[model samples]
Target chain A: MDLIQKGKNYLLEDNFQIRASDNYVNIVSYDKMIHFDNKEVKIQYRNKVITVIGDKLVVSKLVSDEVLVCGMIQKIEFR
Target chain B: MKHYIEVRIEGKNIYRFLKRLNQAKINLYHIRYHGINQAYIKILKEDYEKIQDLKTIYDIKITNWYGIEKGKKIIFKYRFFLLFFLFGLALFIFLSHIVFDVEVVHNDKKLRLLLQEELKKYGISKYHFKKNYDEINKIKKEILYRYRNNIEWLEIKEVGVKYVVRVEERIISKEKEKRPIQNIVSKHNAIILSIDAEEGEIIKNINDYVKPGDVIISGEILLNDKIQKRVSAKGKVYGEVWYKTTVEYPLFYQEQKITGKTKKGWSLSLLNKRIELFSFSPFRHKKIFSKPILKSNLLPISLNYERQKELLIIEEALTKEEALEKAISYARDKIQKSLLEKEKIIDIKKLKVDQNNSKIIVELFVTVYQQIGMEKKIEEIKKDVRDH
Candidate 1:
């Protein structure tokens, strides 16, 4: 759980490599895979927490050597 | 706060690149695959700048984002028109059902009546909906086939759901043959005033006295004193005759003075039903009297009514002179109805009188023209026409 929290925090606070788009985004990852169904999008490390708003979040351990915060879907936000 | 950016590609290998992006944890919505080499895609707005950097990596072109904006507007715009069109269509269907007419025709009257009963059974009467045309047509065909021999033509037509049927009747015409004539004679002792002949001939001459059923003219025609051809002859003959009579009156009588007062009221009754026109009252003196005059005609639309009333009167004793004068007037009126045509009163003379305790019986002899029993027969004459 701590590692999951650590990975979530890393994706939210740290600026990872991503390709921004109108409906979706592509990201590279170097961590264990993380899955979420458009909910519980948070990473808390000590007293610092990183929050992301989207439909889903994912983590993948790949040779890219970077934590990929994929699934940057448009989160529902009201004005 | 993610803003989606839409992308359109106008080059080859676009699908392959899109699949690569999906594998890299990219989600897409409102994505349309135009063809094998072309595609349009929408992505998060925050990733807009990053996807623009990959423009050099893939041969992609971002065309105008008109399709998405137009699609969103279309959803709301057509909602108004769709509801209005449905409302109009429903109203038209309802009104069409209300005013549609239906008719049925058959050559045979028996078959026509039978079909009418069947149509009524199926709720297809004079006023029926056109939308029910198909069902009604099926029913009509079944009926026609049932009476195929009786019906020559069967058609079901609809003009905006109205139907009309006309029928023809087959029959033969025949002329009426003549029947043997029975001479129409006067029931009373009256001259043949006039005759309205439908088909007959007249043979009796004027002033010829006729008896009942005596052949004044024969319907059997005779030529040169021998029967030749037959035709009915018809006409009327008026004959001058005489009748006389005298009435006797009493010399003493009680008369009532007329006060000339009346009460008016009306009553109604059903046809052939008897109803009393006035209510009877049991009161007053025993000598008081009332009279009823009944008058009824076919034109008034009423069965009948009686006009009855009691006359206010005072009883009075008659003098000898007044009694004699009244008796003479009564006798004159009696002979007036019995007088015949051209009959003159030859003389009137008092004969005798006999007096009782309170009344005097007076008699007279008045003479007038009269024809004694001379029976004349009305013969039926028959004529032969050249047209035959």
Candidate 2:
């Protein structure tokens, strides 16, 4: 990519920015959402899995480059 | 900072639908799960039509709008109502400030007419709007200054879209001591029509030609060719006067007539440049008249309304007789403007006619019945006699 193109696409990278809290979890640069339900939300980044297990889980904001999951977050596991 | 629309999607396995939307590179916001197969999400406003183009089993219902688009949506929905309200407000302001009638309160009909004419010259006439209170006061001061000799005081009072004018006439105390000797003279050379004398001896009989400045009513009372007493002449004389004029009119006439079809529309004006808004297709040949609907003092923007009227032209070739008649009436109108309301043309005669290649010229001799009395002081007559 050109210099300007690389700078504009800063959010679309190989890694992810995962910020988890007691009530919510925000993830940036997630590749895809593999599974979604009220109880669990599983996302992938470069063949790795990040599962968010909680009650009444909701993807409050969703995009290809960023995702914000807001709920009563109980556990976050990366595999 | 992007505008969005809140939509609810309902179908079997809406999770797969969200995945399908993401694969299509569409962004969704605030995805709240309502059931196992339904959810509420926000998408970019421009992406709304793209979502409809996907054409799936999902039922997408728009619930609300977000960001700047929300304000625009509300405005578009109630545009007609807003337009009506603004027009009504402008009409109220235009009606309240307009001068509908002017009334001069006086017992003397002549003084009242003189004052009304003076008021008309100062922009206090009917159906005119003003700029500011200071300007109206300035106009009032101007009228009072000009009439300071004829009137002692003049007051213009505005009462509910009308002007009530009150005036006091200037009367000199020295002139009221005795009978000021005066004579009534003819203002124009004319044949006397009638004489109604209340205080003077009539010197000119009916059908007698009296020239300008000639004494028609003498202040001297004569008995057997000798003056016995002198008094002021107080009377009215009606005379027949003549005026000669020529008027030219085209023999082949193309008259432009108004079709009476009118359409009203709004426009925006900045300085001298005007842009019409909400206007329909105009007539092929038309005239536009505009008034301000919304005006701002601080900004140069003003909303004005333009009324367009259709015009139609009819061509005809007049005969010699018809053209002559037209020229005669045209000459009468030219002379009628200089006459008072009570004075009018009594007779019109065609003196001569000169026809050209494309035009016809007619000369007319017109007669009018008018008041020909002008008061003159007897001292001027005595001075003339001593000088001669």
Candidate 3:
């Protein structure tokens, strides 16, 4: 597991999870790191996530890993 | 430390940037804005390093400026003094008019009125201001020279805009006294004391009382009731007149120094001033008469400096011997003043001075020399009134 999964597993042991479709890190289930090639993508680490809608950055919850960028909408890819 | 940098941000960005800069402890000494947009900021050298990093946050521009703040302050200070100096100068120029005083002096009212009218013609009147001194002086000189024979001297001096014209007039003695030639007659029934006769016939004896209007010395002589010759009946009749003069004793005489033993100074009429026989005294105990001048009296002028004298002021004290002699002398003088033709004193028999209640009362007994009597007769003069 990556450092992101390690921080997420630590939260999962305390009944925490990361939700992808809602663009947030919550207590849903253990989810792997989902990287996207689209410009609008949600980045998750530990029990928190941030969605970058174009160049604008938005944080969904209080977490150690959060970053968002929102501007011109362009292509996106997951990693 | 980061290198220093300056920033010129939009006007709307100043509030946010200044707040952030202040939170970061960036010292801003001088801050100025131009056209409501660009702001020049001066910061401490320590804060310059960190402020340069905020370029990405604020559009920053660097510009070098000289010390314009201190220069503006100095200019304001000098401008203030210049304004005050100008105000004071204007005030001084404004108050240079307005006559301070007007003085008029003259012996004759008619002359004063004439002079006043003449002065009015030359724009000189009471309460007038804005008078030109040189022009007034020239005008005054012209007028005075036109009447040089009448006017003695005149001068006009100016203090501020007020003028003082002092004048002096020529002296003109213009009076004559006339004496009447009349016959001398006895005023009452009395004994003849003494007589100094010019030309007259004696008729009565001494220690004899004569009737009123009775001729003490006759102008004409008569033998057996017939008129003989005519003569001038001129003589002084003096009698033993009783007088009681009371003078307060311990007269508490007070005298001040009159003549200063130094070079003359500005005169004061009171004590500490002396009148040389030539110079006139300004003050007198009494005034007998004053003659005024025409046109000169209205100009604060004096025609003459005649000194008046009063006998009440005693310059020197009288000793015991001097007092007795003076008493007799004063009695003699009184008798002489009362007589028509001058006569001498024959006797001062009784003189007693008694001090009572801070006073000395003197009673003098006197007998004077005079003509003895009058020859009573009227001679008829032949006057032919045929010539029309």
Per-residue error for B95 in candidate 3, Å, reads 4.0
Cand. 3 Cα-lDDT:
0.51
Off by over 4 Å in 2: A1-15, B1-3, B32-37, B66-72, B103-112, B152-160, B164-172, B179-388
lDDT of 2 by residue, A1-79 (tens): 5876767666455346888889889888888888876689899988899999999887778787777877888899999
Report the C-alpha lDDT of model 1 over B149-235, residue by residue, as the tens digit. 555555656656566565443344456765444443433344543444443445655455565444544455666788665554444
Question: Whose lDDT is greatest here?
Answer: 2
Error of 1 at B356 (Å): 22
DockQ-based ranking: 2, 1, 3
Higher-lDDT candidate among 2 and 3? 2
Summarize candidate 2's per-residue lDDT along B1-388 as a digit string, tens digits: 7888998999998877887787788898778778777888899988888788773889988888987788888888998988898899999988988899999988899999988887777677899863356876787678778877778877778888988888888876666556678899999989999888888888899999999888989898999999898899989998999888788899999989999998888889998897878666867777889898889999999998888899998998999889988888777787788788667889999888999988998888889999898888899978977998
Candidate 3 residue spans exceeding 4 A from truth: A1-79, B1-84, B101-127, B133-150, B159-164, B183-388
Per-prediction fnat: 0.00, 0.73, 0.00
lDDT of 3 by residue, B105-140 (tens): 667666566666777777676656656758877878
**What root-mean-square deviation over C-alphas does model 3 reach?**
26.2
TM-score preference between candidates 2 and 3, better one: 2
Q: TM-score-based ranking, best first? A: 2, 1, 3
